[model samples]
Target: MNCQPWLKTLVYKCINIEHSCLLCSELAEQHYPLCVACEHELPWLDEHCLRCALPLPMAGLICAQCSRRPPAFDQVIAPWHYGFPLDTLISRFKHNGQWPLGRLMAEMLGLQLHHRYLDDLARPDLLLPVPLARRRLRERGFNQAGMLGRWLSKALAIECDEQLLLRTRETPAQQSLNAQARQRNLRRAFALASAASLKGSHVAVVDDVLTTGATAQAVAQLLREAGARRVDVYCLARTAKPGQA
Candidate 1:
C-alpha cells in the first residue's frame, strides 16, 4: 500500500476546516457554502409541473394547462423557486459578475440532479447551454448559463457542447415581454451549428431560470427540427408565470 496516501489523510484530519454560510456566516453544515438553516429557508418548490417545473398546488402530476397545450420540451428539473435571495443572487451573478454565488448555485444544482438520478431516469446524451446573444455576451462578459453547464457537465460526467447550438439573432429581453410576446420575440432566434450526427440524441438545454419558458420551448423546437430525439430543460430556479404586462 502507498504510505503517501495515508500521510495526506493524516494531515487532512489534523487540520480543522471551517465552512461559513454564504448568507449568515454561520457555521455551515452543507457542502454548498450554505448553512442548514439558510438552505431550509430558501423557496424550494415542493409541488410543481413535471413538464415545466411551474409551481403547482400538488406534486407528482402535470398541470392542466400543460395537458391542454403541451410544450416542446419533455421535462424540466429545477431545484428552487426564483425568489428571495436566490433571485438576488442570480441577478448579481448574471449582471454584476458575482461568480462565487453562481458557482455555489451550480454546486447545489449538481447535487440535486445527482441525487435524483438514483431513479434511473433517461439521462441526456448531450448538455447544451442556452446561447446568449452576441450583444448580451459582450456586455455581460460571460454567459451565465454556459458557466452552469460547465459545472454540471463536470459533476455528472456528461458531454456538453456549447458550439453546436447557435443564437442566430438577438431579440428583445424575454423579461420585458408577456408570454405571447416572449414567444414571438424568440421566433427564428435559434439555429443549430451543424446537424451532423445528432439524429436520435437526447439533449438537455441548461439555463439559470425558467421564466415564461418561452426560451426553452423555442430551443426545444429548434432542437427537434435539428433531429434531436428528445429535449429537456434543466434550470437552477423557476419563476411563476407573470401576469401579462
Candidate 2:
C-alpha cells in the first residue's frame, strides 16, 4: 500500500534534516537558509539611488529625477534587484503560495537590514506593512508584504503594526499604470486608523518590491500628513524604473 499522508510528510521531514540553499541546492550549513556561495551570488543590489534605491550606475547618490521632485520616503533599503531567479522565486511565493520561498526571502532581507542597522543606519521606530485592499486580500488569501513584515519585525525586535494603515478603496493594479497614472490611482487611497497616530514618529513601510515607488510614495505621504517625522521604504527587491538601465 502507498504511504499515508502523515507518513509521507514524516519522510519529507526526515529527508530535509539538512537545509539546502534554494538557489544552488547545496547543503546550507549555516543559519538563514542559504549556502555561502549561493548567498553571495544571489541578485544583490548595488549602485542604486540613495533615495528610492533604484538601480543605477553610481551608489550613495540620488538620481536626477528624484532631485527634481523628491519622494516622501527619506530612505530605501533593499538587498536585491528584481530580476532573473529572484523574480521567479518571488512570483512563486507571492502568487503561487510557495511559502518556503517567501520565508527564505524574508530571512535574507532581515540579514541585510541587520547589517545596515549595525553600521549606523537609522532604524525605523516601527514597521508597517503596505496594506492590501479587501478585494485583493480576498483574492490572494494573504498579503505578501504583511508576511515579510512579520519575519522582519521578529528578526530585528522592532514593533510591527499592520493594522494602523488602512486601504480605503480598491484601485487598478500599479503594474499596469504609468508613473502619472499610478500616482493618480493611489491618491487618497490610504488612511490611518482613528486610534493610530504617526505624530513625531519614524516608520518603515514594508513591502515585497519597490517598482516605480508609487505605492511607497503614496503611503509615505499619508504618514507625513499624519505627523510622522520620517518614513522609509523597506523592501526585499527594488526594480529599475520601467525603461531605465
Candidate 3:
C-alpha cells in the first residue's frame, strides 16, 4: 500500500483553521491567518513592467525586454516580489505539501484581484490554471495552480476550467533554465483542449509564480492563437531578473 497518496490527501484536507498567523503564530486580526503587521512586512511589488510584471525601478514603465519584444500575454498581475518569507512560503506549499499556506496566499490574491476589478482592471471571462505535466503531477500529487484557481474561482465568482489546457509533453524543470532555454523547452509543450472555445474571450492563466514568464508566454500564445481576445497571467509572486535577486 502506497502511503504517499494517502499522506498527500491528508495534507490537502488538514488545514490550520485557527485564526493564527501562519508566519509568526500570532492571532490573526483579520480573516486570513496573517496579522496586519506581518502582512505589511511582505515583500510587496513596488514597480514592475506592465507586460510581464518584472520588477523595475519605477511605475508606468515597460522593461527593456518587453519594449524590444512584447510577450503574448497582455499583462501580468502579481501582488508581491519573490523574496524572503514569500519565497519560503511558496516553497513549502509547493514542495513540502503544505497546502494551507498556498490557500492563504490565493485568498489574498483573490481580494487583490477584486479590488483591481473595481479600479478598471478587466475581469477575465475564465480562469485557466497552467496544466502540470503528467509525470510531475504524479510525483507532486497535486497541482498548485489548479488549487489556486479553484479558490480564486469561488472567491471571485469566476468560472475556472481545469481542463481547458493540457500539458502535451513532459519537459525539464524551468528553475535552472534561462529565458531562451525555458522558452525552447516549453515549445509544443501545451495544447488547448479539443472542446475549448475561447473566441474573443478574456482569460487569465493562474500560477504560483512568474519567474521568467516563459511558461506564461507560451500558454498565452497558444490561447491567443486559439482565438482568445486577451490573455493575462495571474500569480502570487514575481522574481527579480536573473542575477538581480
lDDT (10s digit) by residue, model 2, range 1-245: 67699898999777666788777788887665678887777788989888888899877888987899998999999999998778899999989999889999998788888898889789889999999989999999999999999988998999999899999999999888888998899998999999987799999999999988889999999899999999999888998877764
Which residue pairs show collisions in model 2? none
Clashing pairs in model 1, backbone N/Cα/C closer than 3 A: none
TM-scores of all candidate predictions against the true structure:
0.91, 0.90, 0.92
Predicted structure 1: lDDT: 0.88
Expressed as tens digits, the lDDT of each residue in 75-105 for candidate 3 is 9999999998999999999999999999999
- Runs in model 1 deviating more than 4 A are 1-17, 243-245
Question: Candidate 1 or 2, higher TM-score?
Answer: 1
Clashing pairs in 3: none
Give lDDT tens digits, candidate 1, residues 25-112.
9888555678888988888987899888898878988887789999999999999988897899899999999998888888888888
Cα distance off (Å), candidate 2, residue 38 = 2.5
**Order of the predicted models by TM-score, top scorer first:** 3, 1, 2
Query: What lDDT, from 0 to 1, does candidate 2 have?
Result: 0.89
